[model samples]
Target: MKLAELAKELKIPTESFIKFIQDFDLELSECISTNFEVKDDFAKFARENIVFLRKYSEDLNQNKSIEDIAENIDQPKDKVAEIIKKDKPKLFDNGKYKSSVSSFGIDNKLGGNYKFVYNYFGKNTHLAERDFIGYRDLFFFVSQTLEPYLSNISVQDWGIHRPAGIVLYGPPGSGKIFWAKKIAEIIDYEFKEIKKYFLGISFVDDQKITFNDFLIQIMKSEKTLLFLEDFDEIMSERSEDESVKSDDEETKEIILHYISHFEKENILMVGAANSLEKIDRELLAPGRFDVLIPVFPPNMKERSEMLFHHMTEDLSPDALLIKILEDNKAHQLPFWLEISKKMQAFSNTMLIDFTQSLKKRIRNLYLKNNSTTIKITQKMLDASLRDASSKLTGTYLDQIQQFIYDVSLNNYEDFTVRIEALKVEVEHYKIVDEPTKPIGFTHNDEIKQKK
Candidate 1:
């Protein structure tokens, strides 16, 4: 069933239903397909929970104060205010919360009985088989953008055509290339990277070829997804401060010429960019590279899971490391919670660095002690974290902030919670040094000046 059809049957607004799913942080792929087709499990869940859904929708549409919310949820006003403050909800003119201030979010935080929403799906058997660690929301968003390729109905009935080009924008090490490959996998396309040399007239297999010829050749063949790196630089709007290379101009022209035929030719081009700030406006027109997907770093929960996964991935049950992890409860999520919190804004690459450093440290410790009873200590964890923090520089944080701002302008509604959470995490790095006393200035002199 289409999501709209379900919403009609339930007498709920389709937009509200979508927001409800997002506010609850539900796994979107499980509830709805890329083309907004309602899954059987979600349909059942909605049917059974119609009463709850109606109340949530009603509350969601209202601009309520903390007192009103507290009264509605039967919680203490103080607690509700605290949660609201923590979440940093938008405010109305009269100091009431905006409709975007999710009551469902607050209720859930206050120990509301929403476990059924998650429990209905039961154990996620598919998650274990996933290629990447987290960002279920991002994966879902990418799937939706590719719905035209996945579903014929989306094209024929809804007029949703496959995007000719896509730009995956994010900070460095945020896994843009990983998602570009995932896009190809999702659409069952041949993954072909357009190397820099391919842009120029270059010899491939002793045959002279230009980028135009390469693109033509790919189009002539089966379905293909062409991945391009440094898209922001290559396709940047030509400005006096920055000169465009002749090759880059040619490449852009060729792409613009060929993009209109991409859908018909079974070709898709995905460009990886650090930011979209400098990309040419023409490139973002509808049916061109209009589909912009923002890849984000792992959140706190995902960070912990990733750490746990990396630590014990290939270890035997009886390995000394496993035993040590088990002894310290290091194999569990809680063991890594504090360290992962400190690793806020750290990219996937940085997390891997932390794991690698920690593993080498453990190896050295074992070599020195030759004991099976070694424990994973906080000192070792902190040392590994310091190594990872090398890459979490001030400039990287600024990039993350810029990415956050870009998403706020482009993809905020779809990823509100993540954007807000990341904003706070980035702010965590802000340092304020105490002002030092002026040289040769004594306390009595300061007191006299004050007098």
Candidate 2:
């Protein structure tokens, strides 16, 4: 029950499906993130696609005959028979369906979540280009590189060069998790998430079995997206000798047999981390989890957009409040955009939190009802912007910059080609004329002149 199969049944061409996927702007399940929007026509198209999918899954079960499926999908019986015959399905006596694209009777069923296995990480695909703001180039790089690998296009001549894995690395709150999900979604693969739930515990055997069950489910699918959050920590749990550490040779056997020798086709794995420097290099081998895609902080324009987006949310504003917001908008867009440029290292989370702080103040004022007018001023937003600025870049912006620069210069060899080129460009940034002093602080030369 792959998305590609669904597309074929609906007579949606590959190009149309690609366009369909690229038009989505999903609202994040968490409040910290937001989903902007797409055009009305695009939204209608996506909805129509989803409607067909739901109906197909619901009506094309084993109880239905070939004629029934044909009627349900609005296709001729001969075409339905052709699809079934190609599957080489087990024939029932009464011309009823037994098992094929729509059936899951072959799977062991321990992975009940895997039963609805057609599309995984379903929300990832619903991302519009503008949603990522400053990540257009990196987004294109990922999509273009992954296009051939996921589809059977490159398999004919370039099978040896298939991407085994992809990793997203950046500072915290830079939307690594969001990007990872989007990648899986765009590929139309089933996305299964695994977290470091068993951290700081010692039930090695149980944890190993649980992890294996996930892999077993992956092996059971046509194409699967396995998201291993904190992958470095997960790998660290493996013991060279499990018996000596946890008194279970079975756990040891599991690692040697199942984990180490894991080489699967048509399965793409993605990992996200704040600092990949601590990760073991062995796991990053070319045939393993190799590609590294950098997810950096938003640029000035993106930050400004983020600020605007968070400020203008799903609120039914009163007349007074609306006026205040209007004034805030008319007078403050340029000022906020300028301030955002100065807040260099600030992340998406920081900007969102600052906006949320403003929201909280507004909420409290409405709830308190102490004052007749809930008048909001630009000064309050100015203060929050300044505070968020200080919280991230602060007096050590140079230090953070240098740290990132040093890491990139040193580990450029470890990164994927696209990321390595970006790293090289970062390493080459000319720092000669720029003053290293923190903003609002006295420089050494200025102090000497004052003396």
Candidate 3:
């Protein structure tokens, strides 16, 4: 079909169509344009017609008769055949279906039927499959689970195998980002890191771009992994009454499309959020995500392993310290590493005070969980130290329970009793072991060392 007809059918202006041809680097001669054998205007053919002609020229070449194109350019079959026979048609290798790499200059292989993901923020990270923390087992589980679904695709079908999309949901610092990165590495998929703000902007002024637009771009590229972080805040639920317009509906529709298409089309799309409770339920339903993995905080065993891994080199923490670190919610590897550094700075005489101070530090950190500018005072430390020492005695468990009840609810009496019991236990132990060390022994151990 003539360029004008293709342009009219595409809904683009005639000038734009001419410019598109120019962009394709083709130079059509005036004589060829004026002396076309057909007498029809040729501006009425649909854009899809031109697209078919441009894309399947070789196939069309097999069936075209010479008189068909010479008779009329307006005839659908003749126009299609004539356009197909072109040396280089406007839609050939230049249509929207062809992948255009974004500003990153990355390669996009659309016909390859592989997914592509780009990561801009996590540029420096190199997460391996084995390095994934809490989600390591979950990743493997999903991998095994999806195999049968993939294998069932018939050989006659053109369906391709792409990575499965995952939704990592939980509270902040729950390691979603870590797992996302590791999964990217594990699957050898290109990580396309999307900035949440940019994504919001892309749909500014009434969701200008449909979710299919984004999906088509990602799904067409080979070996791509799309990681959408902080997706909850972007698609937060809000009513019309609230100041926040409900972008949730629009976002959910897009996400639903993404989930539905990716599962069947072999494209892997991953989304992560701080809280699942805050997310739209429609996006979390079974068929869409397929798997919803919660990246929880480190449990006791994991915490112990983390502590040992981070501190085994320089610090010689005792069994009690290890147990305390493992039991305490505040004792993460990063926190313990800081404590180890502090301990390394002090002299022999200060070591006992420092070791004792560690629990207080840990407690203070715990108290600061949901705030900043909080400090650990001598009062809190004394109470905790006393409680710790008392826990060694026969009544320790009972006292601890009472103490926890009292302190948790601000019951001063219960709290005081627990503290006093711990103080007594500490004094008793100190006295019993006092004679073993010399008064001037600068490097004497503080706690009794077990064999």
What would the per-residue lDDT of candidate 2 be over residues 38-63, giving only the tens digit for each residue? 33443344455566444334433446
Question: How close to the true structure is residue 281 of candidate 3, measured as C-alpha lDDT?
Answer: 57
Which runs in model 2 stand beyond 4 Å of their true positions? 1-130, 157-161, 198-208, 232-265, 316-323, 330-335, 363-378, 386-403, 406-451
Q: Which scores better on TM-score, 2 or 3?
A: 2
For candidate 1, lDDT tens digit of each residue in 19-47?
A: 67766766666787645678898999999
lDDT of 3 at 377: 50
Q: Which whole-number lDDT from 0 to 100 does residue 309 have in model 2?
A: 62
The segments of candidate 1 whose C-alpha lies over 4 angstroms from its true place after superposition are 1-72, 84-105, 114-119, 122-131, 152-160, 316-318, 412-417, 428-451
Best by lDDT: 1
lDDT of each: 0.83, 0.52, 0.41
Better of 2 and 3 by lDDT: 2
Q: How many clashing pairs does model 2 include?
A: 4
Name the lDDT value of residue 101 in candidate 3.
11
TM-score, one value per model = 0.81, 0.53, 0.36
Best by TM-score: 1
